[model samples]
Target: MQMEPIAIYLFVSALFILVILKIKTTNSSSKLPPGLWKLPIIGNLHQLAAGGPLIHKVLRDIAKKHGPLVHLQLGHVSTILVSSPEIAKQVMKTHDIVFASRSQPLSAKIISYDSANIGFAPYGDYWRQMRKICVLDLLSTKRVQSFRSLREEEFSGLATLLASHAGSPVNLTQMLHATMLGFTSRAAFGKKYQNQEKFISILCELLKVGTGFNIADFYPSIKWLQDITGLRTKLEKLHLEVDSLLDEIIDDHIADDNNNTSMHEDLVDVLLRVQNDRNYEITRNNIKAVILDMFAAGTDTSATTIDWTMAEMLKNPSALKKAQEEVRRVFSEKGYVDESNFDELKYLRAVIKETLRLHPPAPLLLPRLSRERCVIDGYEIPQKTQVLVNAWTIGRDSRYWEDAECFIAERFLDSSIDFNGNNFEYIPFGAGRRMCPGMSFGLANVELPLALFLYHFDWKLPNGMKHEDLDMSEVYFGVTVRRELNMHVIPIVSKPV
Candidate 1:
């Protein structure tokens, strides 16, 4: 019996090797883009791993050496790295529909309710319907506007908490995350749900696991590898935990009669109200998936953006002073900051633009899958090839910006460039059909809290450290990136003008 088992294993191993050889033979004929020479079986994974955990930075370095449009055989997967705006435009704009679908990683598939969510759903009618519902019902301009008071209330609590710890070192990272959590909870769940903290913890774990480089994702043909590596088991557990929590929330919403008639209908209420549409029927799992997408995308991205903006300003005091002066000059008379006069805060907006240019929440915007073989910049890209647009590299490209590496807010002062995806050179939110629909909603979350933080307090680095000494090292988590270390700063309440 033991000999029989060994014989079976040997046969399987031989089969796998033959399959890999066949794939290599087939790809050898294709005119793929230029890339570093890769080894058999492992492909360029060793090269990528050698460049460290910061995959975006590693890919940026590789692109600089090889070219902007580089191809790599990552295990069994064919991958494309786009570091230049022109190629990014070609892939995301000129040939957008051809590359509109997302690459479904194993983690995303398991955690996102089998890729049912808007973020990872396959490009089809289901995805289109879900996105439409999200835009029209949840993220519409009017709907986001309705949450203005909720934002103010959450920020007020944050400001009060900051005031209580004025002279002491405060973890701005944690505080900002908490504020966003509270705001998002009320907006999505109709109230500060009791399980909000638990949900946040689960989501954080999901992001960590989902974003981390998974070996199984690269080698999909090795089905048993996931089980051997225990990644599948971990993801299954996470999915169960998240599913249970979401089920409880949805059940509560279904049980609450008042939710149906409430003036301030939250996102859950909207989803529930629309679940039975004959033309676009949505299941309970689908509802949970969309809700998960909202929480995952809505909270972390906004909070991280605010966090990075603060760190960048603290490091560049001149830019910091200019931004503070502008905020105070505009809002000092009103004694509070709100969205009403946000249009006048030009320099502050510029500061935010600069921050995003340097530190996009998703350094490598969500990977796109080519629907069919297409020619990009004269290079033939294969069907189902995974595409990663290095927004971090494109943002800092010297061809676009003058002092590309510096934190200069003035560069955007008179410039017409914006991050709405029209200007391919600076796509913090991505572009094309797969572009984030919650741009306005996310910016609303970021701009208000950031403006309030500046208006109410003068910040100092903890332990008497100089601004230049502050650590701005970043850690990538899931679809977003944030400072590796929580920002510890002392807040000095500004005197009433």
Candidate 2:
């Protein structure tokens, strides 16, 4: 007997509805966290649209109404939004292993070579091995410390350029970006490449694309939506262009090995030696992906930190005065600010800490995914639920901080809070197994450049501007967030070489 076509379609549709109904009825026993009432298909998405600010701000506002650990359902995805330190600790430390996996945004999948890199790779042996290599062999304090000469050399070049524009308002954004790129390039690729500008331009474009808060990430069930949205095609094109550049770079290094040139072994050299070993599964693509991570992680983050600290300092004259005085006093005694007396620059350290508290590099700290159903603070977090720790909101929560929004460098003077992930209330670099491996490298880039600029030059805002008049709007990008507007400052050569 031949089945009618209409009957076949109706039977299939009925099965789909029955499955969805079964899911809603069976799994509804678990007590989910506080959230807006869910509606079928697009649960609670309407609540998000009735917004003033989107993304982190929206989530923060939701937390105020719903509580620290609020649950939200968007399409088929289950989300746990964390906005308080106590709950953040419960998620990041108490059940670290359970929530160790990454959510794997669409942008990360394409750009990170299908989540092979450390930044986006799921929780597994691969992430462990990559992190071990990077932390111990590449970004260990010893390794980062060894590159002090390279950092100083790059700092000298930037200071020279800034000194040339003594009385004129100089472009702080461009100079800071260039210096950071120089540091990252020299550290990772053996030398600052001749085409550094072109490379940086591509990097900026990549970060812009990987913002991680787009439609492609939120709705993953419908494949054609991303296609019709054109995000997939655009990212693929960018990835190919970036891959081509890396191809030439790796080939050049391989050819350099063939020639046996006597040169300092940089990070690429270290990875090549590691890849040659048969003990590890370090593929060529792995080396390239890790290299990409180093460049991306190292460059913009340092620049953004410096930009924010400087802006914050300018806004609060007392902060600028105190920080400058500490650096100057140390310089006056030692004749130059070298790494030897790094311990004495307590105030400068405070300024940087305060800046981080207010403006974390990765504000939301990259969403985590739950591997199994778990109870955190009596709230049931379902398996495969996407988790986001609101680092920005937690940092400013009045419960942990006094005058949370104010830029008070001295706030950290007697406080034990640090960004090393040990302090739950202040986790800018995240915590547990998935914490950033390059924390030391990132901090070194920020500290040295910030020290050099403050020690050498006396800065003035454009056209005799008052500190309070300065605009400090931020633009959140892929891995880090930075000021939206460009900063201009006039440099007076205070301490001569």
Q: Clashes in candidate 2: how many?
A: 0
List the candidate 1 regions with Cα displacement exceeding 4 Å. 1-30, 259-263, 495-497
> Which candidate number would show the highest lDDT if scored against the true structure?
1
Model 2: per-residue Cα lDDT over 108-178, one tens digit each: 78878888888889999999998888887778888888888888888888888888899899989889987
Q: What tens digits encode model 1's per-residue C-alpha lDDT throughout 1-497? A: 76999999999999999999999887764578898888999899999999988888999999999899999889998999999999999988999999999988888788888899998999999999998987888788888888888888888888889998988999999999888888888888887667878887887787778768789888888899888988899889988988898898899989985845434788899888888566678999999988888888898899999999999999999888888888899987888888899999999899989999999999998889999999998889989999999999999999998889999989899999987899999999999999999999999998987888888889999777999898989887776889999989999999431
TM-score of 1: 0.92
Q: Cα deviation in Å at residue 354, candidate 1?
A: 0.7
lDDT of 1 at 243: 88
Candidate 1 local lDDT, residue 147:
86
